[model samples]
Target: MTLDLVNYEQKAHEAVKSFWSNREVAKQKQLLTGKADHGERAGVTAGKNMDGFLALVLDIIQANGLAHAEIHQNRSMLTLPGYFRPTKLWDLLVIYKGELIAAIELKSQVGSFGNNFNNRTEEAIGTAYDLWTAYREEAFGKQPRPFVGWLMMVEDAPKSRCAVRDASPHFPVFGEFEGASYLMRYDLLCQKLVKEQLYTTAALITSTRCAAETGEFSEMSSMTGFRPFVTALAGHVAAAAARLD
Candidate 1:
């Protein structure tokens, strides 16, 4: 890797380490090592962590060829509605070609495999409603907006990988989980939400990927290898977003 990669990872680590430090989630989880509960909150926090990690990823993705957000990019993070609004607010907004092409919500499983998953299912579905409601009201109408959704998670190599199932109908129940893959399990979630006409657009994205520290290249980074990967990924995303025009 280049010196720039090293620098980005270093900065990324600091950012992730400081994540839960936000007053809103300070009590949710401990910084550094991370908090407990291990299910949906972990996913939620991981999503939040991705927000930090993206700083590095977005930088790299821009260099490559992918749409992404930037540090100085014209963007804003706000409360979703009530306490729920801010807590469940969309993570990143990508502006491309003078239009709104996407909205992302990052989530990862930090041992939150059981109960926490259920909670996140609720939050995600609920937040989707909030997003759509906000969207039509000109939340992202500064230009043509594409209704997009992203649900990402960093899961531990589980002892058992469960089969995928579409599980949003059973909301507040099986919606959070059908087996192991929460994101995919809720694969039909976007469709269901759309069917309800909850939102005005149909560009949806939901993916589940795992992360581990294999080639940490350094003792400090032994816990995870996402720092480098995401750093390299940032540039690609940025370049893509810039190209949307």
Candidate 2:
């Protein structure tokens, strides 16, 4: 059978809840048990949970005719007088639909969604800023047209305090507010997506790893980003990520 998100969620929830429900287990353990580990995956990083999302991105790249999910590429060809390092980088680069597009760093959410927004905002800008090197080079030499793109994965959350969607709608809308107006000109491809409207397809998944017979809490569903046309869009994203060298 396919992976059941509900079951995984419940398991994580119960693991977290057990901190309070089973005080004995909390008190008994020494090195591994503490308030620090009170919640389910309380210490897991955002990148840790984004593997699946990244996989989807990889699939999007390939389906649309791009290349592999290469990482940590060095592009610092020139050195500045007194500025940031010469070597620059983009997370994943591939020629999408025949154009060399760079799928920059991915930003994810963890802890309080609002706080997560701050972190991701910085990450998004940093991801884009790497292009400054090429821009400077262009000023001196033949301009190299590099198509950059950003893929964000908003992880699921429940706690109101940690829930980013609850903190501000703009948290999830970072791409619109920040990426849309970064450079002299916006990406025509992305603009086309927005004007034409784009989307991705995903199965509605929920996890339920609660107490076996204790009967506890659960539920979440969103179709806002899903549309019939999304299948085509997702395929494009996938193919784009796959075609690059």
Candidate 3:
């Protein structure tokens, strides 16, 4: 069956625009209140900059045939049992007929690229490991494997685009990462996440702060682009709907 992608390209453009504009608005609000955070944190402390992307994903789920699926986005309802911990909160969760359908995480990085990049990578990998191990332990009950997705948006700036060198004290680092920029590293991370079956799919996107008005964004590679991410999600949701029929 053909999958409906919900015209994600145009929607994604608008999402990007919203992301930038929201950040600016949050930063300005904090400043006006005389409680601004240092650096980019002022912009992200509101924690709603990624909501537009979340909406886009929700549209994909509904358009593909999961309109009846119970989607949880509230802070209290987004937690799932973890194998190593008590619980882990995801950005979004979908359930239907007492079965988990999907769990998604949306993240972004604006500055502090060096430290933040490593942190984001470790968090992504660890989150997937915890969730899948919990699945194996029957945390969500016996059911088909659910769709797991990770999507990241990073600021497209010279700091993120310039080549970065890693220090190898004992052994050499991977050749692919010899001089790769942070953006390239993110693309590689997303590709490896899918290649190793860690997640159903991962995507990377970049947008400038000025994109607040133009809604401009760029993808590092087709493999980790928004199109493939939404396509995989639509197919999964449609298949899940078919099974419920």
Q: Which prediction has the highest TM-score against the true structure?
A: 3
Instruction: Rank candidates, TM-score, best first.
Output: 3, 1, 2
lDDT per residue as tens, model 1, 108-203: 444444546567667767777676666667655545444344433334334213554444665555434455354344334444544565433222
Q: Give the clash count for each candidate.
A: 40, 32, 0
Best by lDDT: 3
Off by over 4 Å in 3: none
- Of the two candidates 2 and 3, the one with more favorable lDDT, higher being better, is 3
Q: After superposition, how far is residue 127 of candidate 1 from its true place, in Å?
A: 1.6
Q: Could you give candidate 2's per-residue lDDT for residues 100-137 as a string of tens digits? A: 34333433333354445545455545434545444455
Tell me, what's the RMSD of every candidate? 9.8, 11.5, 0.7
Better of 1 and 3 by lDDT: 3
lDDT comparing candidate 1 with the true structure: 0.43
The order of the candidates by lDDT, greatest first, is: 3, 1, 2
Candidate 2, residue 37: lDDT = 48
lDDT of 1 at 99: 52
